[model samples]
Target: MDEAALREMLDAVRSGAMTSDDAVAVLRRLPFADLGFARVDHHRALRLGMAETVYAPGKTPEQCAAIVAELLAQPGSSPVILSRADDEQAAAALAANPGGARTRATVVWRPAAERAERVVVVTAGTADQPVADECACTLAAHGFRPVRISDVGVAGLHRILDAVEELATADAVVVVAGMEGALASVVGGLTAAPVVAVPTSVGYGASLAGVTALLSMLASCASGITVVGIDNGFGAACAVVRLLPSAVTTRV
Candidate 1:
């Protein structure tokens, strides 16, 4: 449960509108819910100002659906996210939990509140869009407004240069790139905002299937840039969330 629900419960008890025993019954599954296959983290939103997400890679389709259902059962505004689901897994999970807005590699279960903070997600090329889509989904699900600037790779210096206003105005930036991943360095140099870089497995042999890009981003000449694993858009989005101030309310 979120802080609002907890406070409301306590207020009900104080006014004699609800019994202490009934309140205890409602909170019995807090901290986590043991679902045998997985222990759903019901208290994460209360602690982190963000909720837990279900990673759907190794788990069974049924397990993923069940976990999603359990998370949806909580009383909070943060959306329930299921990431990296294949066709079968997405079908199954979306079937059991029918309302998530689906995107490439990710699905979001609730309509997040629109906040004022702006996060710019920039991709090196058209090929990097799938990774950028994943990052956008996570950012929107967590209530951060994601501004997408697409196919602005450094190969055409004029393209990324054209987006200077969009880049410079953001509260945080996520750069998804492949090949030498020079885009991250370019973006890092362009914006004063905190930048998080993602190396995608989108290049040929010499790119080392993203390792070359990963290393290039890690050793970027631009100082204070953060690099995440290859094609890990969800993690990149989470990093952006941590970098920005929390939009979720504390006393509401």
Candidate 2:
């Protein structure tokens, strides 16, 4: 339960609108509700700024559905995000909730879409789209409308420069690149917005399975770019979300 829901329950009990026993029944599940296989953390949103996210990498479809359902059942101002979902996981999460849609790793509430801020997701090539999509979708879940600029590898500087208008208006940017990871540095040089560098495993042998890209991003010449792990789109999304404007919200 969130603050508003908790307050409503308290008000009902104190005003005799709800019986003490009924109030107890409602609040008894405040912290969590056991589902045999999983214990859903209903109180996470109260402690953190958002609800507990679903990590669908290793979880079964049923478990992901149950966890997503439990999180949705809680009242909160922010939308929910599920990260690292493969195709099957994405399908399962969508099947679990009628309120959400298949968007990369998770589904989000439709009303929350209006609050989606502006962000730019720059990708080096088509190979990076999956990781780029993960970042974009995760940002959308956290209320950000991501502008995608794909196949703009540093090999052709003009391609990236062409999208300067969209890049300039963004509150933040996520750069997903695989090879030398030079796109993040170049984008960081062009924009004042926070740049989240995501290195993907899309390069050849010398790329060392994304390790080269990861190290390149970590050692970027750009002054203020932030580097997440190889293919860690979720981390980049969360970092951008934290920088979002703070508005007081009523939670249930």
Candidate 3:
């Protein structure tokens, strides 16, 4: 449960609305919920200002669905992120438990309050959208607005320049690129905000399936940018969320 729910439970007990025993039952699940495969960390919301995220890549669809179901059963309304979810797995899980017509495991959550301090997710081209989408999804789940600038690679410098205003105001920038991955360095030159470069496995034989891009990003002359694992959009997003101010309230 989140802080709001915890407060409400205590307030009810203090005002004679809820019995002490009943409150005890409510508080019992604060730390976690024991699923056979995973101990769902429910307390993360209280500690990190964000709910525990589900990583759907290595897990079976049923396992992923079960974890999400447990989280949805919590007392407070908070956003959850499921990273790298398999399309088929997500469909099956959502079909089994449609989230009360309001929520969708696939439908990302966006906060209206953070429209101004939104993160800019710049993609080198269409091939990078999947990794870019992963980054954007994580940011959305964590209550930050993410604006997409597609196909604006170093090859097309003018396209990126057109978005100077949006780039300037962004809290952080996530640059998803493959091939030479030169976009990150160019973006780093332009923006003062921290740039998180993600090298995707979207290159030719000589590119070494992103090894070249990875090395290029690591060796960037840009002094202040950060680099994540190859195609680790979730890590990039988590970094962005840490840079953002603590969220004041849980979003429905």
Candidate 4:
């Protein structure tokens, strides 16, 4: 549970609207909930103002569904997220919790109330849209309105140039790029806000399936650029979220 939920529970107990035993029963599931193969962290939102996200790579469909369902069943308004879930896994999670909202490889439920943070998600090319979409989706889940600017690679400097004013307005920026990955560096130079770079596996031969882009981002000409792993749009969004102001929240 988040601080808000815990506070409400305690208030209810104090007001005599709920019995001590009932409050205790709700808190008995605190810290985490054990479900054999997994120990779902029910206290994450209380700790980080963000809930634990389920990554569906190694887990079975049933496991994915169970985790998402458990997260969705928590006592918070924050959205529960399942990332990179395959069709089967997505189906199971949806079946388990019909309220979920899906976007490509990401699914979210109970979207948090919008926070007053300006964030931007920029894509270097159309091929980088998937990574950008994931980043935008995560930002939305966290209640940040993401400004999207797509297909603005170095090949078309004019495109990014035209959006300079918009890019400069964000509290944080996430640049998703492949190839030489110079877009991140350019965006970094354009805005004083933190720039989180995400390299995608959307390049040819020497690009090394995003390794080259990752390296280029690491060696960016612009100073103070934050770079996440290849195709790690989620991490980029998390980086941006961490930089935002924190408040007590409930588990999603």
On TM-score, the candidate that comes out on top is 4
Candidate 4 runs further than 4 Å off: 249-252
Q: Which tens-of-lDDT digit does each residue in 125-173 have in candidate 2?
A: 9999988887877777666677889999999999999988888888899
> Candidate 2, which segments miss by more than 4 Å at Cα?
1-26, 86-92, 109-113, 249-252
lDDT of each: 0.89, 0.79, 0.78, 0.89
CA RMSD per model (angstroms) = 1.9, 3.2, 3.6, 2.3
Model 2 steric clash pairs: 2-252, 116-143
State the displacement of the C-alpha of residue 89, model 2, in Å, after optimal TM-score superposition. Answer: 4.1
CA shift of 93, model 1, Å: 1.6
Over 1-252, each residue of candidate 3 has an lDDT whose tens digit, in order, gives 777678888899999999999998877887998998999998986777667877777889888778878887788756655556667667755675575222223333222234356689999989988888878877776667788999998888898888888788877999999998989998998888889999988888888888888999999998878888888887888777767646454345
Q: Please tell me which model should have the higher TM-score, number 2 or number 3.
A: 3
Write the residue-wise lDDT of candidate 4 on 1-252 in tens digits. Answer: 777778888898999999999988878888899999999999888778788999999999999999988887777666789999889999899998898899998999888789887898999999999888999999999898899999999998999999999987889999999998999999999999999999999999999999999999999999999999999999999898888845653223
Write one digit per residue (lDDT tens) for candidate 1, span 141-207: 9888799999988889899999999989999999999999999999999999999999999999999
Alpha-carbon deviation at 248 in model 2, angstroms = 2.8
Error of 1 at 158 (Å): 1.0
Ranking by TM-score: 4, 1, 3, 2
Model 4 residue 249 CA deviation in Å: 6.3
Q: Estimate each model's TM-score.
A: 0.94, 0.85, 0.86, 0.95
